[model samples]
Target: MPEGTPELSAKDLRTLIPEYEGLALATTLLNPEPGEPGVRESSLGGPLLWPADEPWPYCAQEDHWTFGSDLRNTTEIVAGTVPTVPILQLFARDVPGLEFPEGKDLLQVVWCALNHEHDPGPVMPLLYWRNEAEVVAGGLLSEIPVAGEGEYDEDHMPEPSTLSPTPTDDYPSRHDLPEDVRDTWEPRFRSPTSGGVMWPSDSNVIATKAGGWPAWIQPADWPDCDGGHRMEHLLTITGDIQLGDCGGVYFFHCRRCPGLPWDWRFDCH
Candidate 1:
């Protein structure tokens, strides 16, 4: 390795990682605020910049996930031996969808920041948090309790004395913001927009294609409310991933996958 070597581009990652061929190029049309600068549409998110010392609990019997390199590196980094950089914002709100509303992603994030911690899929906001980057900036998203009643006190902080367990007669639906709390959560995550090629890669995602035909997965065991179909999730690719024979756990980070571009010269000179 050279001293001035640059970081690996998403294209380069495809080659370094095996089993890359099993991926489908699913595009997430991010509904960031209009005219927002630096937010690139059709952009691919990948190569999750994890911490050397992961704050997550022990999964199975294995040690926690190492942020950057090896244990020595993670320790050095944590003990102020290695430099610490501000964690970047790598996660999007929703699991990429067609016309997926703006505040929806934030709603999911807020929900994660507020209530649900681990595997928040089937329970809260109907979303998943596997590869989504923990919102590190606002300290909103932290390692959710791997077990039990969660650990954060922000969302759980007791409200005003009057805000008790007793519920009012009713509440509002569509929120108009400063207008009223009732209408606030009304229009957020409306039933996922149906019709058209919404989720081409989702196993449970059901949508009518260009030919007025439904497409998605259907099985007897699939869970549902009204017996509807369910789409599968984009999975993380984990195996004996080795970076120069020193194995590094590999996860499927979607960088628009250029069909698993084999190793490139990199030097654009």
Candidate 2:
């Protein structure tokens, strides 16, 4: 719902709320630079085609749960230097009426490792990829093993960097809404800041932090599967471009649920 966008009227939301149940909340405005036409953008550590023989994803949580312990004095494993700003990327097959799962394609990447010292308690480092080319040619020749390695300090490993796509006019807008959410759904949806709104549940007005973006409070249920059904609303993932607050990272799926390890779900706020 990106170009022009403005169609929400189930009789003007049943006249503001006569038990309205048409469910209206939509937004999809992401342009991760580099030829933006249909999601193929990058940022968090910019530059990816990775597979130089895999093995670059480290957390090894001990107490380094969410960017604590001086996060290796701001990454590159101790600031040996290499990250030129990049902390979020969203691509669920370029989003635009997402359905996915049938050749599989999805990617949500995020990374932030610059703390200097205090107030750096929101360490960002999230990755989820499920591109299929025969499951990446059978897991790109295996080499996975590095979790908690004797408790940190190998220079505090945390590699996997390269992302490019920096173009911004600060997209996502509904003109700074928040006057009680434009007095409750602004006469029937269209202002969760324009490019952000999807409510099947998880109430939402945005407020959830931890590497930010992910809020789906209240019985948003429908993310546990056994192939019963119900779980579809793919696309939200907004922290805009990362720094701190401004939540939203909701994604769900269940194309008909079969393989792909129980469809998808990346709830946030």
Candidate 3:
């Protein structure tokens, strides 16, 4: 638990609903606030400690556009690929519980900020795991390419913010609950004032989180890797950035597979 975060223990909830006893999962809530964070620090939408020698990533998807009535910034459409923007940078030191690949201590998330109507996910995000020491040893990329004005979907472009990683226990949303468990608890989750059934979906923190279950707005859609192993939730991006109609982007990885193959899904309210 981090300081000043109101104590909302899932363990206590479990005492009232024993069905949740075996469903609690350990997770870290990334409480992000607008600020300037160093490249090497754990941050949301902050500068990355990228190797200077390595080529920066760009979105070559042909559908990339910058002009549209629906877009936040409706400037003239730009031609060719748009540079992928930084969304997150995490240091193992800041989040010790995070499982980094062997010899890797840093995790960076960058993505194409433009919309992808044809694709399932709104933003085509990418993940990178790196060694902090090796990046510094090689030399850091001083100038990272960014999407020029009107080149990105403003709703998806997050402002740089520092992170306060707070450890906590998270239980699955009612949708992810076992059929029997949901059936037992659903009827009891009524609101006294409204006299309407008020499901505690937000009990699972709907923020940028690591591990635990996803704060799903709809039915849970867990993806599987080529190895046939069910993927584990790696990270959930929300709150700090406005996705499609207050949606969330989820990242998942399969630890059982070599190289930890990953996938993503997007859901909106």
Could you say which candidate leads in TM-score? 3
Off by over 4 Å in 3: 1-12, 67-80, 186-198
Candidate that would win on lDDT: 3
Could you tally the backbone clashes for each prediction? Answer: 12, 16, 0
Q: What TM-score does structure 3 among the candidates reach?
A: 0.87
Better of 2 and 3 by TM-score: 3
lDDT values for all models: 0.21, 0.37, 0.80
TM-score of 1: 0.19
Give the runs in model 1 whose Cα sits over 4 Å from its true position.
1-55, 62-90, 93-230, 236-269
164-197 per-residue lDDT for model 3 (tens digits): 9988888887678888877876467544455555
Per-prediction TM-score, please?
A: 0.19, 0.30, 0.87
lDDT of 1 by residue, 1-269 (tens): 22333333334323442322223234322222222122211111111223334543212211211222343442111111111111112233323332222332321111111222232211111112323233333233233332222222122221111100111111111110123322432243122443121111222112111111122122112122222333222221111111121111111212233221111000000
* Clashing pairs in model 3, backbone N/Cα/C closer than 3 A: none
Q: Give the local distance difference test score of model 3.
A: 0.80
lDDT, candidate 3, residue 180? Answer: 86
User: Residue 241 CA error for candidate 3 (Å)?
Assistant: 1.9
